[model samples]
Target chain A: MNEPYFREAEERFCELLKAYLPYEDAYQELYKTEVNNLPLYGYGVKGFTLSMIEAIMNITNNKGDLKLVEGALAIGREILGKPVELLEDVESTLKSLNGDYRLVMATKGDLLDQERKLLKSGLAKYFHHIEIMSNKNKEDFQKLINHLDCAPEEFMMVGNSLKSDILPVLQIGGNAVYVPYHITWEHEKIDHHITHDHFHQVETIKEILPFLKSQSYLTKETLK
Target chain B: MNEPYFREAEERFCELLKAYLPYEDAYQELYKTEVNNLPLYGYGVKGFTLSMIEAIMNITNNKGDLKLVEGALAIGREILGKPVELLEDVESTLKSLNGDYRLVMATKGDLLDQERKLLKSGLAKYFHHIEIMSNKNKEDFQKLINHLDCAPEEFMMVGNSLKSDILPVLQIGGNAVYVPYHITWEHEKIDHHITHDHFHQVETIKEILPFLKSQSYLTKETLK
Candidate 1:
């Protein structure tokens, strides 16, 4: 539930470039082209790393050295290898809700990378199912709901990104609780001006407990 | 069980390059580097396409044009979009084995692309489960076996590549039946000198039926 994904990537890119101008320029071009072209080029740490290297080369007006390319790729691999931090109170919240409802972790990324992270996270025991998605669009949410054999009104999603985690669920008639992460990827950010009966914005992951309690979404048996 | 995967990719590459020396040179270099670097770079259609584009640019002594890069990526996307043809007797063979044993389709590729091809293939109904793997190493097989809640000995893998489908299973103490495809990726090629009690090499998909029947692997209910 916690990922300063873009921030971490930018930090790594800046560290590799060691020049603010090139790093800034590369970041700008990468987000502009790569985000829009993700469906065409596909999405993952590997593609992002390659795109960043290409952007840096173009902005610096230098054909990059092979060794330098290897260095940048190493950063990509590092990003994949790094474990994502869980939001404070995430485990307790999951523990409280575990048997009351089926807890599932739904995230989008390279399958191997995500699977490796889950295995390393020490959070695998909390989830009934772990779904690593390629993309999180409305249709993907619909497919997941179908797979679960649950009515849209009975499904609830909680995550940091409005575009990916909230809007898709609301669109499919499912309840969604938005827990804003400290840092959000530009690709995942969107205007939150719309109104919906099933949507609520919260400051942190822990707030979802009281919100769900207020909404009668969870039974009192496990609330203790 | 039928895929001209490598052949088609090479044809597309040669057509784009229109020069044997560079094509051969790029292909050799790409396999040498990409395969060795797979654990770091990760594997999939997108990564392979990016590596090929980088390879071509190096061999041709030119920075790749954006349009040319797009064309090469289009080739990769094309491969992902192309559905593998089922061998002539595959449907009948699967139908016979359908009830006798659980059928699962395990393939390696980009997640979205593979899911798309599976949806388009009209062959999704034959398998009880579908696994889209990032790579076909023994560890990946071990993970699958763990997920399936079965021991290695209970598994039987049948596929086109000796490296991917057969050897990994054999190494893990699982039964493997190798049904060689007409065209195999050079990277997937390996010497088939090893033998085990559970290993069988068949000429085609139909031959597997008779072999399994003789071995008493299939229940008599289906063999009749």
Candidate 2:
């Protein structure tokens, strides 16, 4: 993110909330309320945008301020229209791993928004296919692993979020390498530590190549 | 669904518009604007809700009226929360076809919204797994067919919308059965007649059972 990504959205949303609510932690309250709305709204810009509007309404005591709604809409449109930015070494790492391994993208979010990001990233061609899920739970991983015709032990997931991409995979007997982003979503933060035989934490995308190249990634070489 | 499906939502949105503007066809205007927003917002109630809010802003000259926003959210929530009502004979016909053929569900919409509907419909157990796409175009169908390990000519799709479900499948050399719904979305309405060897039209869900039972579904037994 280089200090300029979702944190940008959060700052803008905080600014929007501050214009209406007196509390300094008003934007944080939006997160708490959104966690409650996750089951109903799920993840994505649309859900987040809706949550912002709902929070605005709640904070204003249903006053329906025209200016606040307009500001919220503008913030949402900006986030939705933001271009996809690739992490450093992502393209090179994919290029290095492309010919030897079969790659698939398993993502969870608004269908169109996820597809749009993939399309704009220009990395869609490297994947065999895209697997879109409602949530990244144990069952979702099991179903996806089954559908891909692979055993859980043989399936490896490389993603940025430990909550969605790492813990569930570890719970289901799969391999997961967590590459934490600098500007992670607060909802994805975990208070506890993870210690598993199949879990590895890496500092960047390119570091996984050495273990993968050995074809025996189960070793304790990269465990943090 | 016989009388109280999406039409109810549309009527509610129209009522919302009538309160803010003097136009008799303001909800119709919502659909027109939504068509233009499809590329950005895609399908499902979330997209529809966003389009409604955007339409209100435009119609009100960016006034962003609080009442209209609340009304739009109410209508969107109603559609999102409404239980999935099975079509007549849907359960019985699916039961009859079970175990004899590999049943699959190919759907499109918001990721969580579609999952919610499938879970609510109690039809999730009937399919091998769900296939959710952003759209139902030829490319989407072709990719799904490829994923399912079936040839285009051997694959069959049974859906309600001609523009989305039938034409795209036929265009890609696949078989399709059209079962028209009573309250068809105007956006899904087609103006042309279809005459294809791979196409069949049925009035209800159970009507396809006869040809499907014979296993020679390509035979000219049920043209109408």
Candidate 3:
């Protein structure tokens, strides 16, 4: 994905997640994991793990086959009592898939809110796997690399902030796209240098979509 | 003056100035006469002479106690109407009146558009003496210093660009507060070395009001 557009989308998605998720701890856990790279403590880990299980269960359904993703299709109808479509209007924007490109998300804490929301929201159908962890240091990032079975250069990490999204990916020689957020909490502060030459700065999210589609390494035709 | 706050206000004021005066040639001329050491062209010299006439006319009100000064002010007023408000605003913001300080404007043309507007806008009440120039270069800047009878250290330059505002001021051993505009035109490109430094960035116009009010060389209390 183009760096600017992906960053914008990720920022918007995070904002929506904050509104939908209950409890202060959920927000704290999410921020720590996604923004601060801090470890998830006792309840946070369990809560996150449970949310992921809920998401997976919702995806499987009783039919035992995964359906192609549709925007805004709510998963976990049995528990939530209704289908919730979180992905909304942007469904048609996603590129058509071929099996060559595997989609994955590396997040801190156990998969909880985002995973469940993604499946419930019908966004989970696009990704093959999601990795949720309590830590996002060098070791965890390396583990993610191994799990994905992809080289650093081959994968592109997209997120908000130069501290979290850009620094680690750049350290590993991976391409990273940063989307600056309008609002950042105090806890998200991380010591990171943002030299003009090191990273690309962009104002909006949609600008990156064309770039992502153009990159051959992430495209189905190139993979085949 | 509080450096940070003054910097912010100076930036805001510069942004407004750029919007009202967007031509590159005018900006170059203004810079050449006001900051850079260079000689004024025919129209620029005429404009400067006319401005001196207007200043004298304002003091003499045509009754000719200072006929030479009044004559100069009349010619200056004929060339530049009320744009002098820009200078008056700066004068009103100065913190004290102990030393001679000159008003230098970096613009891109031979006419004093900003100076005329300030006078016509009913803002002239705040300023006593004014100098208007369309072209500013190193030599013109030196002439301005001589006209004001002050050393470069005792002087300050307020403007919007690192290339035009901060760099030249620092080169002359003068303090400068840069107020960056939200959008910059293609013609205003600066050397990469100047913008890379964090010391020069400012965001707002109101922040510098207090800083100017605190300066010992200019009197803010008397200005109002």
Please report, in order, the local distance difference test score of every candidate based on alpha carbons.
0.71, 0.79, 0.43
**Which is the better candidate, 1 or 3, if ranked by DockQ?**
1
Q: What digit string (tens of lDDT, one per residue) describes model 3 on residues B1-224?
A: 11232233223323323423444433343334333211212223232432232222233343323324323323333433322323233444542322333333344332223333444555444443344432334555565566556676666666676655566666766666677764543335575755322134446544466556565554433222
Best by DockQ: 2
Q: Can you tell me which runs of candidate 2 are displaced by over 4 Å?
A: A1-4, A213-224, B1-4, B213-224
TM-scores of the candidates are 0.79, 0.91, 0.30
> Who is ahead in lDDT, 2 or 3?
2
TM-score, candidate 2, is: 0.91
Which is the winner by lDDT between candidate 1 and candidate 2?
A: 2
How do the residues B83-171 of candidate 2 rate in per-residue lDDT, one tens digit apiece?
A: 78888899998887767656788887788988888888898887875888899999999988887777777777898889999999999
For all candidates, the clash counts are: 0, 0, 61
**Clashing pairs in model 2, backbone N/Cα/C closer than 3 A:** none
lDDT of model 1, residue A222? 25
Clashing pairs in model 1, backbone N/Cα/C closer than 3 A: none
- The segments of candidate 1 whose C-alpha lies over 4 angstroms from its true place after superposition are A1-29, A50-78, A81-83, A149-154, A192-194, A220-224, B1-26, B53-78, B81-84, B95-101, B149-154, B171-173, B220-224
**TM-score of candidate 1 relative to the true fold:** 0.79
Worst 10 residues of 3 chain B by lDDT: B36-45
Candidate 2, residue A132: how far the Cα is off, in Å: 1.6
**Model 3 - which docking category?**
incorrect
